[model samples]
Target: MARTSTKRLIAQARRALAEGNRSYALMLLREAHDGAPKDGAAAVLLARVLLVQDHPMAAIEMLAAHLARNPRSAEAARKLSDILASVTPVTFSRVDAAGLAAALRLDRVTADPLARAAGLLLAERGEAPAFTRGTDESALLIALLEAAPVREPGLELWLTARRRTALESLAGPAAEQDEALLAAMARQTWLNEGVWPVAEAERKAVDRLDPADPAHCRAAALYLPAERWCPGRDGGSDGMPKALAGLAGDIRRERHEMARADADLGPDISAADGTGDAVAAQYEANPYPRWGWVQPPLAGAVRAFLDRIAGGSGGPQPDGGWAGGPLRILIAGCGTGRQAVEAALAYAPNARLLAFDFSRASLRYAAMKARRHRLDAIRFRQADILDLPDFEPPFDRPVDLIECIGVLHHMADPFAGWRILLDRLRPGGLMYVGLYSASARRGLTALRERIAGERLAGAGIDPADTGAIREIRARLLARPEDDFERALAESADFYTLSEVRDLLFHAHERPLTLEAIGAFLEGEGLDFLHMDVRPHIAEPFAASVEGGHGESAVLDLKAWAAFERDNPDTFDGMYLFWVRKPG
Candidate 1:
């Protein structure tokens, strides 16, 4: 029952399984399980062995037993859900389905988004989109949507922007007059895991709201947030339409109602004068990078990460910080707090998380979500990232990890902000950075230029004008100058009004090249840790790089530049990479 004994058992089990000795492996695994009865890793290993032996019923029973003990074990939950989902309809009995649903706890609003998606999908609940309507893969892909809310750390924000044209075909831009569709919109926003990006068919619906009739205000709750697509909604300096004014008031009230503290939704953070102020303002209005719950990584992926923060393998802590204490994590530019919440949930047992954004509205939404999920370790503040020197550090301790993704590129002088944060991170501490790629966005920028040239210089149809946007997308799709326009239509970012504007109308953005990234790394004196890339592409990249540039875990940006030249869409979530200051 000793910890060392359990480790030895696991090692023996893995070796036995590798040598085609299932019975020995099972015996060793059973010993490991008894040693740590609630260990999800033990359950996972045992299940893999059982499934290989065609004993799925035994596997399910084992996993369900572990899950009953460790309810929040993201690993046990995922294994159970995946097996339950994969069984043939005839073989999957009601008892099995109930077991899966119980693990998901579908009655709750914030279960693991993917698990919920898979459950609904396996249950044949939420209807499939037209593309997958008749295909056998329909269930699989629809189920993936549950897990796909935020594909990468920052993809939830920019993804929709790129897929605006394609998203129209998914679940948005419904008729305002259709009560059934409107109800679906409301359900999509609240009851569902993530926002569905609905579009109102009528632009004039905002003009028809009666200022005298309060009943008209009821529709304003869901309608106003979805109405962000409409143009001139924010241009109400004077003499705004009665219906528009009413809706605006309702939105303000709704945000206020959701506010957690007295000054929760106030402009404390946005009042700063910073390089990224303009970009911050845009997100203040419509927070980017939206996502919901996600199953944490598998236990085997990072054994220590399965529960608490552990000292990094990168060697001794450079700051010589205490080893046994919790990790220090900062979620810079934590919009609406999902990223921060994910961190809190993932590392709640052994980390202190501090999240701050320049948008109070975003923070308010994040606070509400954190409270709903009971993520208590995370602390939210209205401090600007630029004022890091001014904001009091929690515990007066240095940070071990900092995540600033899809934000720096928006700063007027992004590098300056980078320098400031770099100073705060302890030597050998890791930082996850996401920046726009120049090579990838080259064609995208050109397409945006042409789209702007056609529109009357910010006087185009309201973004709420889904019909008009669709017409524009259709026109571009029909007569695309090249593959870029077609790519936009097919992209996941082609969906919402906010997403469309983010892709095209971003006021301040500059793409970075891998060469530039290398230079930045050299200038910052940070070691490149890893670059997240598609394995399919990375496979050939590894081969090519080994032949020419040599192999390294840290990416070769010069080689990456060439790679992007050949595959421009490689950095859709931008170039997200990790780095650490020299230990």
Candidate 2:
């Protein structure tokens, strides 16, 4: 089909969906995919819808074939990889040994996407090729190992053997040739509690790596906070690229900040204002959502979801301001300004945005990022979400859209902060909230008790300190692999010391059941609007909600709760949803 024909088919598919005709929509999408098998967008859209309908393997096959034809589509390849990650158990058993072997051959850095995908799928099933001494592991393969434990239990033995094998190759001929790869592997293993002994030659190899090479810089950065090794120095420093130098400096500065006493954290951070002193102090030490955008490897896409919502194609604005003056958007608890900055750039020329965080250090870091990116579209302030009434004007002014994600749940009383945010929204204003899901976090809840009992997390220790958390996880990982390893490894937070600490350990947190959320919304007279998850996840949700009758019904908390009963991981991180005051 021609490009115009493809566009028309996609439009027709979308219409079919909007009209509650999923079968017809799928047919259209299938037609669209067949017409453009190599088009990343078409392949992903079709595969995604299939996944939502519970035909995961079918989705995988479609994407896999598409990738075979168009290996260059990172977008499509990533989609295939995600499906493989989720459906690996089924895929592992279904993939004949021959196909698995064929897939493994393509795991090289520059290999076709099919090969990389195969290696990752194998790793997810705990069958990454034996780690031979002096051999190279693709970056994707390493990520698969880190996340595999969650997908398949009892992977500690496999992961441990792989770690030891990689360690044995240290300072071997291959290490000398690709020392950066060794350093990167060591960093990953360290997070998993398998710190390879750093030989002197290995240290020298990493230290001498030139800074200008972005790839090497990333590998070296991973190795920088070595518990026993000095980064960029042995006897003296070899100059790095300007970008690397900045990052090296920031890491050191953060270490210093983490070590500072609470007294020096100032009145706002140290003193309990809205959230209790403990939570404030924890974030102040860490300065969350640790971004390295300014110096190097700027995020290719920032404020990803919000940007999509704001740039929503010719749709009704969330605030019902589709035909009116510019909208006002507020990012409550704007950690390090990631969402705030994204909102600014995304909605600019159409909406004004104000972002505030309780932690001054966090706000400062966010400001630096905005300035670095030359995004003046946002203004940052240090304020508590609970103190919304006291915020000075225009920052305090009622907003058409308020985004309070990953914040309220940490409060001593989530409802208190929630009520304040609701009051501050103009009538008919929209609010986006993210809070922990009780069902999804059952693992986290159990692990916390086990962790404390194991003497890994307890009194006299600050969970916010990356060094302390690393030691704790190291000890946890070193032990005979147990039940908790999966949750620990599955975290994106596991990629970095600070983030890992945040995920497994936090000063304050509360998870809510869907039923409770339903009650809360009812009590407050707010309307449950929508979610960002795949549509198939929401397909049956409508029929279960308070007033829902079919696909056209409003997405309600009751329906979400029902969905989560069987799909417990539906909101693994948190239930992110939009609500309105109902004009």
Candidate 3:
């Protein structure tokens, strides 16, 4: 075959592969191989194609041929080694026995199969295996003895019995050995195979240690699952500590109830008023009131969005690259100030950051973290996002970024709040706004509201009391069938994907479609640079014919007819939009 033909065929195969036509690419590679039987390049391409198709053995054979021809090909050798390590079980052999022994002696090959095999091979070569001071040579040897099938029957039987006897002996007098080794062995067993029995045995041995022994508690804690310490209240089973056992069942029950109440539409029965509608009332009664933010995921999403925009070419230009000076940033509804502090530390190390939230308690917690880390750049303030008393732009040279994630959905008029934010953005500045998507969450909202009302009416206890809260949570959990209905009812409000579009872009009464969103950006002095649907909004649920769904089709449809008419772009569920003012 001509060299030019081989090159053309390889290029064609690469293009097909890039386009995800793997089968077609493989056919081309096979044809090329037929034409150029001894061509090393053809063999290499065939090997790569086979590897992608998961025929590792075929890849190995092809790569081996290629390597034979090109002995100096480190890339080919590395690829061959990786495939071999992944597929072929590492076995002890005389060829590399000394190297393995040295690694084992240094404790570098502990627990890994290839390393263990090498060590065993070295030991078998009549060389005294060098044992590291704190290394577990006995355990390594026992594992290798078990893995390698002995050709000599008598020798095999003796080795097998010795391995078992070694484990038994070490396990029998567990109190005499280091607690760390016992815990490590237990962890290894658990990782290799979910052998809870081994872990349980190890835990029992550690528990037998005297209370005064420092290692005793550490060993027990190491063996204990994290869930045992902080078990989620929702139906998860984890044994609690004796000191916390009394509260465990109650906490679990409370968690169950809270989950249900969170799902329902009614007021939380645990609140001072005994209504499950605290969230609804909090927003509905005072959309602009001081609100408390929780959950770092919510805050982090907003921060990421703003950072993306601010750093982009179309948005505000940084004064001196990212490190030239700190960019002034504000996190509205910055609960606990985690996102705010993170932003200060990440983007504008020298830049001033003001983290404002309505809850004094949350701010206090944020302050504690800031002080602990000795971060002097962040300033935590307790203030309402809706009615800012003295918020001026250009703290240094205009607020470069503003993050408002879940806050907009809670407001009575989110657009009003959005406009207020837009006015605050410095020219070429970026604002990250998240609101609920209507297309996805309307049905949920309706159901949640209905369930919350019923629960609140039935439960006569004060919402603020622990008992009342417990009762409310219990009621919600009792009817697991209506969990979604309850959640929608309790949450402040949800927007559909289309609703988010209309709220952010369209001022007209009629909602805009995908086409309209793009067109509107051109019409208004604003530019819709990018938009991202919230990740949680895409959660799959059972499909229904009632038009109500959890996933947003509006956002999913990337290209659609532009809105010819002035329509409202109303929807239910949360969405993030990055819009910019022309510089």
Q: RMSD per prediction, one decimal?
A: 9.9, 8.8, 18.0
**TM-score head-to-head 1 vs 2, winner:** 1
TM-score of each: 0.64, 0.62, 0.39
lDDT of 3 by residue, 67-178 (tens): 4445444444444444544454233331333222222223111223333233334355322232222333444433332222112222222332332333445345654443
- In the range 1-583, model 2's lDDT, one tens digit per residue, is 7888888998898888788888888899999989877677888788877976778877777665665566566666556555654464344444332323222223221122333344445555454442333323343344433222112223334543443444344434444323333343443443333222333454566676553444454345444453323253332334443433443454455444433422322345333354456677766766677543211111324233443434344333444343334778788889777777666665555667778777777776677666656776576766776554355556556677898888888888888889988888877667888899989888888876565555433554556544556566655555554545644654545544446556777777888887987888999988666766655555555544533666334455565566688678878878888777766
Which number leads on TM-score? 1
lDDT of 3 at 232: 69
Candidate 2 TM-score, C-alpha based:
0.62
> In terms of TM-score, which candidate is stronger, 1 or 3?
1
Q: How close is candidate 3 to the true structure, as a TM-score?
A: 0.39
Those runs of model 3 whose alpha carbons end farther than 4 Å from true positions after fitting are: 1-316, 322-325, 348-350, 391-397, 455-469, 475-524, 533-573
Per-residue C-alpha lDDT of model 1 across residues 497-520, encoded as one tens digit per residue: 445557766657877778877888
lDDT agreement with native, every candidate: 0.58, 0.58, 0.45
Clashes of 2: 1
- In terms of lDDT, the best-performing candidate is 2
